[model samples]
Target: MAPHPPQSRPSTGPDPSAIDTSRRPFVLIWEVTQACDLACDHCRADAHPARHPDELTTSEGKHLLDQAREFGPGQLVVLSGGDPLTRPDLVELIEYGTSRGLRMTLTPSGTSSLTPETVHRLSDAGVTRLAVSLDGATPDTHDTFRGESGSFEQTVRAARAARDAGLPVQINTTVCAQTVDELPALRDLVDELGAVLWSVFFLVPIGRGRVLEPITPDRAETVMQWLSEVSDDAPFGVKTTEAPFYRRVAIQHRRDANETPTDDDIGRRLGITAGDGFAFVSHTGELYPSGFLPESAGTVRDGGLVERYRESELFQSLRDRDALRGKCGACEFRHVCGGSRSRAYAHTGDPLASDPLCAYVPDGYSGPLPEGRVSGD
Candidate 1:
């Protein structure tokens, strides 16, 4: 087999411009199962306790891996789920994808199943990286957010075990009204865990997450600005999940310090919007531009993923930065920070609408602004 692509970040980010996103996604997320042990408040999947009877079979999973490889070698495939560990054939699937020249990553629920043996098994199976969520620094807050009594401990243990097993660990944190207060402490925890990356996921109200609170645009602005400061010295790389304005904030921060971004910087921090550089495949085979953006392009059961992603109207609309509406459409950083399509759809029915969470409003644009305008303040 071809050696796996060398990766500097857990996300395996390559130069975004070199890759033709119209034909292939930078990252493909496959929800292997919806069956999970934890009931996370912000769970996009609204995961089930038992596996769906119609969940893709092991053979079907191999076929999907084959389809993923069609994107080209070194395609990043993240095996996400309610908890990937629930799937007994997860390792087999990872091995198969790795053999097909896909850079395989896994996001498993932190539970009793995340033992050292399980981590070692995943490492031995050619899994490129392991991402575990740690929303809060303390057990009380994190466990409460997860709706489990011991999930915090399990998450910490699993991250440590993954590190000991020679697996690069990435910590996924939720940023919202409920958990945002703990971010500073969680940053310390991320450093303590020796994580390679800290993926701060700004919450999008979906499913169980609908009941949870999203931070206001001003609050998000403050947080992203602070995170920009944190990234300056944090050992691990930092990326926001649903908030692309962090890129805008970072760029502005650097420029304010009279630092001009190099050519490498231009490609490394691309804002991968829904249906742009990212794609998601549900457990039932439906292909979405993003898990948070439920607008399905088609199902694998009906058509090939390549056709849906490349030629579908929805994907096409999302990829066109010019098609974006309101402030996002006029923003100078539109291409580099296209805004979060998922959050845009959640706030406005139009997937091409501007992300309300971003406080930046481009100058000289007279269109109606987002609800909370930190406009020129």
Candidate 2:
């Protein structure tokens, strides 16, 4: 028998990007553990079976929470890792962070640890949101990417459990050459799971991810075009991670359609790039511009996070679009879409290099490649 086609619907909530967060970093990604049971092909943490002995202690975690309050009160602190659920003290950490007036989110690798009881417990512990990774639509595709059999089934079960427990779920999908073709099917799956948000993370090669081939610049642009169309009719808010250029693409699309673009839309696009309104603290407390951009600014143990982020050379470089090398520095959309530093760094060793995955030739770009422009992998 033929199955019924999935129905298209509009998102009930406001655009996820429109949610007002202060210009300062209003969110922090804390990798609380580096241990995982699965060896996914594109794992940024290069996770292993055993937990790191030097991973942040419970006392240190509480202290980091204290520092986070000073950095941005009521900030959204995301508890992530190879799999945050691998840590026995995850709930305790969540409770502590919540008690400190921080909104908390959890990202657990879909594995045996994400049981039904675990979902309810996380909801009870004041986790406002739960994000699970779903790279592919089908079991064979997804499980193969995750490097574990039945991972797709387990992730589905976990997502359903989280939704049924009244916890909002966001499905994070990694978009790469290998997975791009499956986005339509993944979208249908997202709708079926009733996910509130579908976050498409463009590949940033680092750690184990270095081996995976990222989609070409032209392909990324095409995917963004498709995403711009999808977001308009999808029942859930759609967002792109590490692909800030989507904002520029959206603005151009709106302009081409003769629709008026709002200031909020522009502000939202310009406000949230890698080091500007985002920061990451590794499992060992080293701070970086973002989880994907692994150049360390300083350790949380060295000084206050706010000070380090504001004062670090890398952060400063990332914030100043004029400092970018190659066509990115000259792009008209440079401010709104400075391109992905992590991607730039992944392809070239310099984090300040232009994002190789951006195909858009800036207005006034000359014939030959600009001086100091680094070639991509």
Candidate 3:
């Protein structure tokens, strides 16, 4: 095997030309607040309801909206939080982003205290998609992970409300050892909900999620296999069987049909661009390169939106020649993997660790498996 890519420090200073306006912009999951009503066991953000008052002020949030708009069309603007609906200013943020031609999604704990009027307001605010976390098919498993007794009921109710409002609902499930066995049942529930998509997030063992429960490699593999099966058969517009493993299936699907997804498709399909890709805007108004990790660039408050694009370390690193090469060059799965830096950091405490979840079968480990050949033999 090729030697592992050399470890190098990320460049600290920003370069003005670093912002790749030439390439379509990334999807921005602007985390409006970290104050969430539910304390899910697997949440990497360590969100809680009491923290909202201390997060981004109303002015800071508006600046973030402006920065997101600079990315232009085909970008997604996801308003997330401990629960976005908890923010009184959510409508303004959503409206501001949508006015800039951004497609948007609102991620709530489903305990957003969203009345029917508020739900319709979100749709009017340009939230075309809605994603609610449903870790298990039933309350026993789900509520346990969410750390709330009635979370399942709340999430289900919110999803139904979103659907009834004509917004496409996607169930976001975080697969862990505790919930792995019930994946099939979860998929069945998605179908019953009439939801349009399912995004399965493998437990990354970060923050409170790690403190609660973690998945074994074997369980991760099991979840990946389950997701692939569901993706093949699922009717959702965006169906990723695996968490980070979505790339492989997406590549084949995009190839076999000879369909080329535009920037919007790329962002939403890969969870990268605006409303779709993995993203997180911090309470300080700094953008983590992605939502799954808590790393940051400078605060949007200290600088204009352009300053973030030009100077933020995360953006700079993502665009750096040496950095992207280090990640993109090694591994047989490069073309399909497109490793997410934030996930890498959250899982291994290093932005560059080989993803632990990537299946690594020994060359001669084949036993009773199909064709009597090992995965890497």
Q: Give the alpha carbon lDDT tens digit for every residue of 1-377 in model 3.
A: 55322222111212222434324344466777777778787777788666655577777776666666566444666677777777787777776666655676788775637655566667766777888888888989888878888888878887887889777888898776788777789888998888988877766656776664656555565555556556667777444422444554454444542344332222343323211223456776765666666666656665555556555565655543234333233433343354555555765576644445545332343332222224553
In terms of lDDT, model 2 sits at 0.81
Model 1, residue pairs in steric clash: none
Model 1 poorest 10 in a row by lDDT: 257-266
The best candidate in terms of lDDT:
1
- Identify the leading candidate in terms of TM-score: 1
Off by over 4 Å in 1: 1-17, 256-269, 374-376
- Candidates in descending lDDT order: 1, 2, 3
Residue 161 miss distance in model 3 (angstroms): 1.8
The segments of candidate 3 whose C-alpha lies over 4 angstroms from its true place after superposition are 1-24, 52-54, 238-242, 249-279, 304-307, 310-313, 319-329, 361-377
Clashes of each: 0, 0, 15
Task: Pick the winner on lDDT between candidates 1 and 2.
Answer: 1
Error of 3 at 329 (Å): 5.1
- Candidate ranking under TM-score, highest first, comes to 1, 2, 3
TM-score of each: 0.93, 0.89, 0.77
